[model samples]
Each structure stands twice: as structure tokens, then as C-alpha cells.
Target: MGLAIGWTDAGIARLLLPGDTPADMRQRLGQAGGSEKHDGQPELAARIAAYSEGARDSFRDITLDLDGVPEMNRRIYRHIRELEWGETTTYGAIARWLGDVAMSRAVGAAMGANPIPLIVPCHRVLAADGRTGGFSSPRGVRAKMEMLALEKAASPNGQFSFGF
Candidate 1:
């Protein structure tokens, strides 16, 4: 199972879930050493609306606070947060990064299980062949592609690097 939790912030219920891991994900959120005051639920809802309306940067840093994920999910999400914006990595590359060279599917599964999708930047994780894979949660998959495109265009590489 993936991780993270959501509370009604401005009526839009924000979730910060990531992939699963062996550790207690919820506990980790409590220990993340960061928190931000929500302007209110309406603002949060607006942000969600913007995100759905094709706003890639329309995300809050607080989304990293997954309070209900497993260890694997945390591991995957932590890695994702390391992304420097305007860049991407592959599921296979992530699996290799975690030393789970044989766990590409698991990496995909973890991504699928991500709760806080855009915030964790799961869309940044693409297929090995440069294809954008499945985005399990709500919102359009094409938007994910668009987000990657945005990042690619903004990145200095002129193309995103997986660091593989």
C-alpha cells in the first residue's frame, strides 16, 4: 500500500501520500520536520482545481507529508522529491537507485500507489522506453505528460535526465 493522509484544508482535502515501505509512513510524516499553515480549505481546493486544470507547478510543498504510507512508498517518494524540477527519471532507474534492480514492477506499483500524486511528482517517473506510464489516481494521464513536457522545457538539459 502507498502512504500519506489528508485533512480538510480549505474544503479540498489535501493528501500527501507516497509509495509503501517497510517503515511506518504516518509516523514519518510526523517527523518530516516541516509544516505550513494552510490559507484555508478554499485555497487548497483552488489549488487542486488548478492542478486538475493543467497547472503542474500548482502544488504545495506540504504535500510531502504522507502520514499513512508504507516504507517502500516513502522510499520512492523521497527519491522523487529529489528531482530538481524540469527533469525526469524512469521506474527502472528508480528501482536501480533503490538497489531494487529486480523491482521495476514494484517501483511501478509504488508509483501507482502514490497518494499525493503531483506533489510527489510521480508523473516525473516515466517508462523505460521514454513512454509515460500509468498514473493510477485521479486527474488525466495526458496532464502527467504535459507536466513532464513543462519540466523538460524548463530544464537546462533541453531534455530531462534520469541520472541513469
Candidate 2:
């Protein structure tokens, strides 16, 4: 499976998995951009492919076009985007970091609304008391747990392993 990235002269507008067509993702996210074939940016596609294959430790320094996302959700995503590989944070913690402990569900909503899945790393967000929380991606929590396992497997000392 390959990655499809929507872009304009500005930057990457949206990122989607091979399961959905770029046209579908653009329409779903209300994004504005022309899509280039995977060959157009072989390096990026390769990086994404490597990550999907569970051969890469982390996706570093990738840019996303978040212009269409809501402001509150943007704020929440910004905080978790910095989460290092093999690390996870709770929805409640993120809501608290945003200065409203009561926004835990709101945080969950933002995670569900996340358009750029792996790039934004929404799987790294968990439920309170270390639950798996919910995942909007295909395969749901299984996908999230698989990603966590991939990272855990690649970690230097396996310190990332945390039982649920």
C-alpha cells in the first residue's frame, strides 16, 4: 500500500492510506489541492511505506496542511505531534494541558477527527488509566495497538512496552 498526499504550492494538504483514493480523502477532509502520484515524491512515499512496513522507528519532520481543521482540534493536535516515538499521553492529560480538565471527551473527539493519522500520531493518545481509547482508522483499536507494538518492537531497550 502506498500513501497519497494532497498538496498545493503551500504544503501537504492531507495524507491518507492506500485504502482510500485521494479523491475520497480530499472530499472527506474538504481539502484543496492537486494530488501527485507516489512517484512524484518517492522519498516521502518510501518513508511512509517503511513506516507502514514497521521498519521505521518514527516519522520525523513531516509537514501537514492543517488549514481546514478546526482551531480547538488544531491546538490539541499540535501538543501531541511532539510526542516522541514509543511514548503515549492520555486524553485527560491533553485536555488538562489545554487548561481544561473537563475537555477529555473533547480531546477524544479531536483524535477521532484527525485527518492525518500516522503523521499526526493519534494512536499515541490513550484513554484515562491507560486504556486503548478509540481509533477512527481502519481496524480501530487493533490498528492503534499494532502501531504501538511496532514502536515498542523498535525501541532500543523495549521500555515502550506497556500492558493494557
Candidate 3:
């Protein structure tokens, strides 16, 4: 599993696809042969580390530069961000929240196309049946399950600490 992050003057520019090799990420950044470190983005890197260690809800505070994300998809992402760290909700439920039950599949597809994964908490969105749904992370559903478990363990109610 590989994690590559991109940063910009505003904040994190994006979370590159989890499966991208470091070289792939570098090429995307137009810095293929250069150092991974940027001039002043240590805070962004530290936030990623904090999330991995389960010591922080880094997404809660980070500013994401989602310049070209579609409006509907952005709406879905906003709702996903509102999801508690450990509590899981269904795609259908999100669609319903959007005032359209028919948009469940669209919600799922939006999640699959999410450019910033962990920040949006797409892992918290499951199938309506409560099974782990598709996760585009490098480890797929297993990664989603692990994230859920980690957050659950971190909270007394098995819900994200901030959920309540």
C-alpha cells in the first residue's frame, strides 16, 4: 500500500490515488526527479501521520483544495465529511439526505471517484445492508474495515469520538 499527498499554498492540493507509486505521484506533481519535500508543507505531512496513528481527526481541520470537483459530488463529499469517524452510514441514507433515494448508486460512484479518500471519510459509507462497500484505497475493502475498527477502538461508543 502506498500513500502520496500533494500540497498547495492553500493547503493539501489532493491525496493522490493510494495505489500510486512514489514515482507516479512525483510525475503527477511534475517533480519526478526531485525531492519529495516541498518548501513548507511539513504540517500537511504531519497531519497524515497523525491520522494514521489515530491520534487526530486531521480532516476536521485541514483545508482541501477541491477546485474541479463536480457540484453534486461535492455535496456528497460534504455529507460524507459529516459522518462520524467510527459510525457507518449507508449510501442510500446519504442519497436520502440529498433528498433523492435514486441517487444512492451515484453517491457510491462519487465515493469511488473521490480524489481525497481518508479526509472525506468515504470508508464510513457502507452498503445499505451494513456490509463494507467499495473502497478505492490500495487495500480495498480490507482497508476500509481496518479504518472503521481503528476508529471504533478509539471511541467509547464504538462511534467516532466526535460523532456524539
The candidate scoring highest on lDDT is 2
- Scored by TM-score, the top model is 3
Task: Compute each candidate's TM-score over C-alphas.
Answer: 0.61, 0.77, 0.78
- Candidate 1 or 3, higher TM-score? 3
Q: Model 3 compared with the native: what TM-score? A: 0.78
lDDT of 3 by residue, 1-164 (tens): 35667665665656654556777677755641223665665676677677777864737677776766789998888777876666677788899999999998999899998877888888888765456667877667777777778787332223333220
lDDT of 1 by residue, 1-164 (tens): 24344453322123543343525454554454323343434555556556544565535355444565689888888888777655677788898998978989999898887766666778778776665678754335565656666555343323433432
Whole-model Cα lDDT per candidate? 0.61, 0.72, 0.70
The runs of at least 3 residues in candidate 1 whose Cα sits more than 4 Å from the true structure, single-residue gaps closed, are 1-5, 8-60, 153-164
Model 1 per-residue lDDT at 88: 75
By descending TM-score, how would the candidates be arranged? 3, 2, 1
- 1 or 2, greater by TM-score: 2
- Candidate 1, residue 99: Cα displacement in angstroms equals 0.8
Tell me the RMSD of model 2 versus the true structure.
Answer: 4.5
Give the range where candidate 2 is weakest over 10 consecutive residues by summed lDDT. 153-162
lDDT of 2 by residue, 95-115 (tens): 889998999999999999887
